[model samples]
Target: MKLSDRQEKIIDLVRVGQPVTSVALADKLGVTRAALRADLAILTMIGTLDARPKVGYVYSDKPKRNLLLDYISDIKVSEIMSKPAVISESTMVYDAIVYLFLNDVGTVFVENNGNLVGAASRKDFLKISIGGTDIHKVPVGIIMTRMPNIICGRADDSAYEIASKIIEHEIDSIPIVETLKVDGDKEQYKIIGKVSKTNITKLFVKMGKSK
Candidate 1:
């Protein structure tokens, strides 16, 4: 879409000197932190923004910028992991393929009794398809990588750590996970949002145009 005048202004400022804190920029813009946050969220959703700790918001003008390394270092997996799309062990290969394609997502989380069990990716679907297995007869459990040493991140940690791990491990995604606390609080982890190539690409485009 269309960006408003203020949004365009924000882009210009970020392009010149990113790694700037929201507080600093917000003050200059004469807007409340809350209002600025709302605007940032809007820009981010449309792939025009990114944020990190110690370096505030970043407008990536470099197309090849290592956002995962340069900016996401302060972010946690919980902050950027997209909502989990769960499938049972019994889910059919045919149906799984449909789900992945329909959602335009690269992978889906396999769950059993609300606990993460495994992961299935587009590559898995392709493999299955090539195996000549009966898509309808086979269950996802038959082919999915079982207990694939899931990579996870906690909400309390910095996103930078999460991004670093992703790059180091050569993995594209991480599941945000949490355990219970001593105070009888139900420890829950819901993938809040996702940070991927898509997120980085949006930031690059927005910053490039701004410059």
Candidate 2:
């Protein structure tokens, strides 16, 4: 949820001070108590502040920690995923190399008919290139590791789950995908985005700095 300037200031004030009374807060903020009612109510309802009949508003440690954990675990892949590097399944290995370098991504999703068919990584391209073959003529589909064999994540999957998949598979990234049914019950997935180890690290750093 987007927070207004006053709401953000309220949070900062509560964080740095002890429980504060509405009168004192309003005086300090140069606003009337009535003006703060909605802000305080929203903060309390959202578990950001604890209010008592006479004790005023306080930031509860336990609730704040729980909120942080919930935020991390409930974060969807779509929230943190980056635009996926993609190539047509029919793209030549030579062209794929050029695209990969231009995009500066370790892996690229290979698509056919709008469906994710496979993936090619820098390692995959290097392996073929080292063989002294005519990569310029070889379709990436022939060298890519196909679906069902590729590890992937869903767009709605939690970021925590995506991070786990990356570690468990020992891969640099996982494609965020959506499942589609085709051909009388056969299912295929379309690539939407990518979650990488770097993304997880950035999350960790952000959480740490906030704490």
Candidate 3:
């Protein structure tokens, strides 16, 4: 969410001053108390300010590291995820290889009827390529690692949680998915985006530069 000029000033004031009364802020801004109400409420809701019954408002006490974590924690996977490299499950291993290289991504999501069913990585392609088998005749579905074995992130998952999943799985990328109910009892994930270590690194770099 974007902050208004008055709200930005309010944040600056709270950061440098002791708990400041709304009346004082209103006077300093040459506006009425009512004018600052919405700004204060928004700042408070976004964790930029804290208010008490009689103490007025103050900046949050969160340290720099914790503040960065808070920022990351509030970012959803959808905000950072990039276009996924996708292929049909029936795509031949040779075609999948070409697609992977063209996309320049580490993994490709395999889909059937628009729902994620499997994924193929460089390793999966390599395994088949080196077997001396006919890559052109082998469908990726035969060698792709199917869902239930795949580690994925939800579109609403926090950036911090998705980053943790990447580290824990020791994989280059993970598909961002949305859940769907099928057949009245089974659930499936539909791939929507992809997140990678590179994306996380870029986020950290951008945040650091902002500091």
Error of 1 at 94 (Å): 1.1
Off by over 4 Å in 3: 1-63
Ranking by TM-score: 3, 2, 1
Candidate 3 — worst ten consecutive residues by lDDT sum? Answer: 61-70
Against the hidden reference, what TM-scores do the models get? Answer: 0.54, 0.65, 0.67
lDDT (tens digit, per residue) of candidate 1 on 1-211: 5778888888888878786788877888998888888778776655566777677888754432354345545544444446656788789989988887777877777776565667777888898898888899998888887664766666666655665676888666566665534448645344434455454445446546753
What's the CA error at residue 16 for candidate 1, in Å?
Answer: 30
Write candidate 3's Cα lDDT for 60-154 as tens digits: 85424555677899988888899999999899999999999999988988999988999999988998899999999999999999988889999
Angstrom error of the Cα, residue 122, model 1: value is 0.6
Candidate 2 lDDT, tens digit per residue, 121-158?
A: 88899999999989999999999998889898988889
Report the Cα RMSD per candidate: 12.4, 8.0, 7.2
Error of 1 at 171 (Å): 2.3
